[model samples]
Target: MIEVGSLTRRYGTTVAVDGLSFDVRPGTVTGILGTDGSGKSTTTRLILGLDGPDAGHVRINSRPIWRALLAAVRGRGAVRSPLLPPRSQRPTPSGALAAGGGMDPSRVGEVLGTVGIAGVARRRAGAFSLGMAQQLGIAGVLLRDPGVLLLDEPVNGLDPEGVRWISNLMRSPVARAP
Candidate 1:
């Protein structure tokens, strides 16, 4: 459901991504791997429309994500980044998930519960530990029930238990389907 064709990006004189192309089909997991400064984050940003590709295109569900956003009122797609907001500066879990609409309190609660942070649903996300913050970010993505899910280092901050939770959640049959 996600497609990248001839993707390229550059910053000043540095080339970050070069003619990248790949497809993430519906109901499957795909990972982009590389060492630091290898353009993984840049690629993710391009796919999510957070950054423009110097030359290339990214599409979700056969339409550009921006177009999809305009066509659908909810659940077009979602992503979480590695640079999370500061705990004290972040919004409450529910508020963050519902900020752009498409989710209600119960859905937010369900996502928070799935990520093992429901007990602190009303707390400011900025107060959570790194692992908890990661969970909340994952929860925000799940709340979308998106046609596409683009995650960049989603488990980077999790403890073993939290890592297992994300593993099981993503492997669930429901999560596997588009």
Candidate 2:
């Protein structure tokens, strides 16, 4: 579970996330929605331990997120936030994921297939359209079969069909497992 309590962040004089608190229990899909400049991305980054909160705490599975930062960075609870760029621009979909350091290289094909981009597995991800790039990012997120998923604007550049596919993937039992 993700338990965020009294979380806050500031950029100079501007407040980004202010005392935000919430729990995302197992077997559920929680969304943080807001306008473009809202703190949604900031909150996700804080939860992922990619950014430090000025005040308050973020706990994942009863452990403060700092304790889990190593695992998180290693891909146990991978995040798919759009704000993060792909690992690289030059490698093919397969090459990029294989180079991510951990996990079986064989699983690269499986994730690509799962995201419906197996046909482009050998193509340079740099040349992909926005929607396909989104798929590539998702495939990277799934490389280690993450236990916690934090997707920000996951469907932003997707087509109608791609959006539906992502919606279904989020609702699937596999995605909801603790």
Candidate 3:
């Protein structure tokens, strides 16, 4: 479960999120609706521990996500950027493959396959179409098997088929499970 209590975020004099509170329970889809500048992305970032809240608390599975992320980082370095160059360009002999305990190189192929883009596994994301990039993004999220998903403009740039596929994918029970 993800819980937010009296969350607030401010940028100088501007208030992005004000005392926002909500809960995203397991086995449920809680959509955050708002205009482009309505703090939706800010709230998601706060919940994911990507940004600090000026006030309030956020808890995931009864533990603070920031604390958890910090701990994870302390133990295994920070998560690697998904935009890193492919194995062929890396300095290591392994090439573009993730070094150490980062994301599994084999899983990259698996996720691409899961998202129905296995044929383009070797292609750089920068060169992919918008829909293909979106699929890769979804595949990246699936890598962690998160119980709660927070998508920002998830349907952006997707074709009709791609949009439908994402809608069905998010509604599936398999997506709600940890």
Model 1 Cα lDDT, one tens digit per residue, 1-178:
7789999999999999999999988778777899999999899888877898889888877897678556543544454543356645677878877774668888888878877889998987666777887777777767767666667777777889978987787787546767
Ranking by TM-score: 2, 1, 3
Give the Å shift of residue 135 in candidate 3.
1.0
Model 2, 164: alpha-carbon shift in Å?
1.2
lDDT tens readout by residue for model 2, 1-178: 7899999999999999999999998789988888887899899889888899999999877789999677555534543543234547467878878887465767888888888999998987667778888888788877766778778788978999999998998998757766
Q: Tell me, what's the RMSD of every candidate?
A: 3.1, 2.9, 4.7
Q: Which of 1 and 3 is the better model by TM-score?
A: 1
Lowest lDDT 10-mer window, candidate 3? 72-81
What TM-score would every model get versus the actual structure? 0.79, 0.84, 0.74
lDDT of 1: 0.76
Q: 2 or 3: which has the higher TM-score?
A: 2
The best candidate in terms of lDDT: 2
Candidate 1 regions with alpha-carbon error over 4 angstroms: 64-69, 82-103, 122-126
